[model samples]
Target: MDQIDLDLLATLEADARLSFAELAERHGLSKTPVWKRVKAMEEAGAIRGYAAQLDAAALGFGIEAFVQVTLQSDAAERFEAVVMAHPAVRRCHATTGAGDYLLHVLCRDIAMMDRLLRREIARMPGVVRTETIVSTRTVKDRHSLASAAKALGKG
Candidate 1:
C-alpha cells in the first residue's frame, strides 16, 4: 500500500463513521476513489469490520481481571476451547513466560469473579493453577495504529 492508503487507514481508524464523501473531502480525493480504496483494503483484510466501543462499567461489568494459567499437562488446545466458549473471557493469549496462558476476564462483581474462578477455571481439565490480578484502573486503552502507520512512513 502507498502513502495515500496509509492515510486513509489512519483516518478511518480515528472515525469509522465518516462517509465516503467526507473522507474524500478530508483527503483531497473524489468519493469514488475514497470508496474504492476502503473497499480494496477490506478485500485485502487490512480493514476489518467496525463496531461501537462500549463501556464495561455501564454494562454492569464492573470488575476486570487478568489471569495467568498454568497447565497440568500439555493440553493447551483443550484449555483453549474452554476459554473461547466463555463470554466473560475477553482475551486470551498463549505466551512464553511464567504461565502457559494469559486471560483477560470481565465480571459483574467480586462474587461473580470468585464463582468464575472456582466453578469454571479451577475445575477445567488441564488447569494446574491460576493467578488473578484485578484491575483498579485503565490508563491507556486506545490503539496506536496511526502512530504505527506514521512510523512505517505510510502516513
Candidate 2:
C-alpha cells in the first residue's frame, strides 16, 4: 500500500471513532477520496469492522491463557469443527511447532478454566494432550493493522 493508505490506517488505528470529516481534514485530503480509500480497504479485507477494546478483568474474564493442544490426527475438517465449537477459545491456530493448535482462552478464574478444560476441551474427540501458559500480565494488546505494519518493518 501507498504512504497515504498507511497513514490513514495509522490514524484509524489510533482512533476508529474519528468522523469521516475529521479524518479527511487530518490527512489534508477531501472527504470523497478519504471515503473511497476507507471503502476500498474494507472491500479488500484490510479493514475489518472496528471494535471497542474491553478490559478482560473488569468484564469478569480474569484468567487469560495460551493453551497448546495436541491431537491424535491432523485432519483439518475435524479439528476445525472442534475448535469452532468452543466459545472460550478466543484464537485457535494450527501450527508446525510443538502442538497442533494454539488457543487463546479467557475465563472468570482458574477454577472456571479447569472446569471448561475438563468438560468441554478435554472431552473433544481425538484430543491427545493440552498444555497451558497462564498470562501473568498483558504488556501490550492491540487489534489494529497499524501495529502489524510496524512489526513487519513497514510502518
Every model's TM-score: 0.92, 0.90
Cα miss at 48, model 2 (Å)? 1.8
Off by over 4 Å in 2: 147-155
Could you give candidate 1's per-residue lDDT for residues 81-150 as a string of tens digits? 8888999999999988889999999999999999999999898779998999999999989875756877
- Best by the TM-score measure: 1
1-155 per-residue lDDT for model 2 (tens digits)? 66688889999989899998999999999999999999999999889889987888888999999988888875557767978987888889888887888889999988999997888777776678888899999987866677567667774
Alpha-carbon runs more than 4 Å astray in model 1: none
True-structure lDDT of candidate 1: 0.90
In model 1, which range of ten residues has the least summed lDDT?
146-155
Which 10-residue window of candidate 2 scores lowest in summed lDDT? 142-151
For all candidates, what are the clash counts?
Answer: 0, 0
